[model samples]
Target: MPFIDLKTQYKALQPKIQRRINQVLEHGQYIMGPEVKELEEKLAAYTGAKYCITVASGTEALLISLMALGIKTGDEIITTPFTFVATAEVIVLLGAIPVFVDVEPDTGNIDAKLIEAAITPRTKAIMPVSLYGQPADMDEINAIAARHGNIPVIEDAAQSFGAEYKGKKSCNLSTIGCTSFFPSKPLGCYGDGGAIFTNDDAIALACKEIRVHGQSQRYVHTRIGVGGRMDTLQCAIVLAKLDRFDHEVEQRLLIGQRYNKILGEAGVTTIVQRSDRTSIFGQYTVRVQDRTNLQKYLNECGVPTAVHYPVPLDEQPAYRDLCKAGHTPASKKIAGEVMSLPMSPDLTIDDQDKICAALLAGIKQ
Candidate 1:
């Protein structure tokens, strides 16, 4: 079975996707076509955000959001060390420091309690990544940000476009929410794409300018920026896929619930989803002993498995000296034990059963 089953999704929406592509080809406005604005509007309405700005990629979205917030060199951005490198890479790219924080062992999300302690006078923002399709505690994070001079909060919602937390969508829960459409994400396009969402009008306008070489208008360079415009064709592809996005989210929830129920009964430690939150099951991850051995056994049994992260960002060679010494125990332990099973909206129950059986056998070995 395929890991994400993107082919199946494509087959399901072939007609719509073909039609959208045909329209884009006829228009021939590849850079920023009418479909780009159309998709942005739909995403803003769906995410309950006043403005949405599409960009070249998720990294660009994060960088643009930081720029819009006026985060400067030597500023500190508090975030978890247990997420994808992009979470911290953006800070370093802008010559800002990423103050590492530990994550919860159960949810693999940033520990909100540890955030405030990491804040210093130089702290300009708090970036929390919504790992494995589950949102971080935005309410708590936002409260901390508010208490500390209203520091900007950027939610890295790359893995959690369809996720919900405390009655709000993941991308709409913070000061600036950034999500990716990197083909494998919950809501993805045909190529690299991302979006930044916010209710603040000024920040939204700044992001629009920052996305296009900091131009307020043609040939009017307003601020330092990058070429970060999302292609119109990619935007069109996302628009086509939007038709079945709600249905895909429901299927992902059902598959995740089923996996949790079966794996729990079989003595597997599934990722915990809080009562006030919903996961999109981007990875269907679990913590298991002897992860390397289990992975080999599953491979032998025709079941594919992978690791979301093999090392904490603090432990990575590039940023080891920058992180706090002797912290991130949970992140380290989870890195060694966590494994992700095959998961997708089209994943069949029979396939899941086979995967579970293989996992149980691997543990026995």
Candidate 2:
């Protein structure tokens, strides 16, 4: 089975997608077009955020948020090590330090209890990644940030656009939240697209300007910025997808829970989803001993598998010397054991059962 069934999704939404694309093409306002505003407004309403600034990519969204916050050289940003490198890459790109924290073994999300201890006077922000589409312990992280001089918290919600925490959407749970619309993501467009969400008016304004090279008005450069605008075509595609997004999210939840239940009955160690929050299951991963062999076996059984992350960012060559990382035993251990299975809203129960049977058989071998 295809890992992420985007083909099936596209087929289902073909008419709407074609119609949206046709409208954009006919208008020829490709850059900063009306569709862009329409997407931002709809996304903001969906997330319950005051503003949503669409950017070229998720990395750009994080970078722009840091710029709006005025992250400077030598400023420290606390984050978990067990996530996509983009989380720390953005920090290091702006000459800021990413202080590494351990993650919870169950969720692979930052350990909120350890966040406060990582804080120092130089700590300007706390960035928590919503790994595998489950939001980090946001309320606890926010409380810690509030206690520590109201340090801004940015939720790296690249995999969690449709997820919810404490009844609040993933991208609106913190001071600033960023999410990706990469083709494989839960609420993805056809290509690279991302958005920043926040209730802070000043930060929102700054992000808007920054996405267009810091333009306050036509040709007026107000601050140093990057060309990070998401094109109108991408926005149009996302707008069309939005029509079926709620149903897709529900499908993802049901499929994820099914995986959890079937795997649990067989005594498999899969990622845990807390009761207080919902995971969109960008990757329904499981922990296994001899992961390499298990993956090989599953592949042989026609079950595709992938790893969300195999190496901790702290252990990477580029980041080892750049970021300040203390002992993260949990991150280190989970890095080797975690393996993601095929996950998508369109994944079928028959395919899921075959995958689980293959996995259970592989584990016994």
Candidate 3:
């Protein structure tokens, strides 16, 4: 079985995809085309955010958001260490210190209760990642940020574009939200693309300016920026994918629930999704003992498996000295045991059953 099953999804949407691509080709305005604005508008409305700024990639989305907030040298941005390095990388790129915090053992999300203690006078932002397509305790995290001089909370929703937190969309739940379109994400484009979302008008304007070489007008340099605009072709592709994104979200939920039930019945340890939130299950992950042997067994049985992260950011060679230390025992522990199975909206039930059975049987050995 394919790890992500993007081929199946593409096959289903071939016609619409071709049409969208054709439109982009005919327009020939590849940089900032009409499709870019159309997709941005649609996505902003979908997330219920007042503004959306499409960027070159998810990493750029985070980097540009920080630039908009004026993060600088010596600024401390508190975040969990248990996510993809991009979360902390963007913070450190600006000469800012990434204050690593522990995550919840069950959900593998940052522990909001532990955030306030990590804050200091230099703390500029609180960036919490929505890991494995499920949103973290955004409401609690936002409340914590509000108490501490109203620090800007950035939700790294790279894995959770279609997710929800207490009726609010993932990208619309915090002071600013960023999501990726790296083909494997819940809602992705053919290539690299991403977006920044915020309700704050000034922040939105700053992001807009910062994404295009800080141009307030044509050839008018207002601030330092990067080459971060999302290609019009990518935007067109995402717009086409948006047509069936709702159905895809529903299917992912059903598949994820089924995986939970089957694995739970067999005594497997899976991550928890809080009742108040909904996940898109970007990667259906589970914790297992002796993960190496189990992964070998599953692969032998035609099942593919991958680890979301084998090492926490703080433990990484590049980030160890750059990030501030904290008591993050949970991040280290979870990194060793967690493994992601094949997950896509198009994943078949038969495939899921076989994968789970193989995992269960592998555990016995």
* Clashes per candidate, residues 3 or more apart or on different chains: 0, 0, 0
TM-score of predicted structure 3: 0.99
Q: Point out the higher-scoring one by lDDT: 1 or 2.
A: 2
> Can you give the TM-score per candidate against the true fold?
0.98, 0.99, 0.99
Q: Output the worst ten-in-a-row residue range by lDDT, candidate 3.
A: 352-361
Query: Compared with the true structure, what per-residue lDDT tens digits does model 3 show for residues 5-94?
Result: 999999999999999999989989999999999999999999999999999999999999999999999999999999999999899999
Candidate 1: residue 116 lDDT (0-100):
88
For candidate 2, the lDDT comes to 0.95
Candidate 3 at 4: error in angstroms? 0.2
**Alpha-carbon shift of residue 68 in model 2 (angstroms):** 0.5
- lDDT string for model 2 (1-365, tens) is 88899999999999999999999999999999999999999999999999999999999999999999999999999999999999999999999999999999999999998988899999999999999999999999999999989999999999999999989999999999999999989989888999999999999999999999999998999988899999999999999999999999999999999999999999999999999999999889999999989899999999999998999999999999999959899999999999999999888889999999999999999
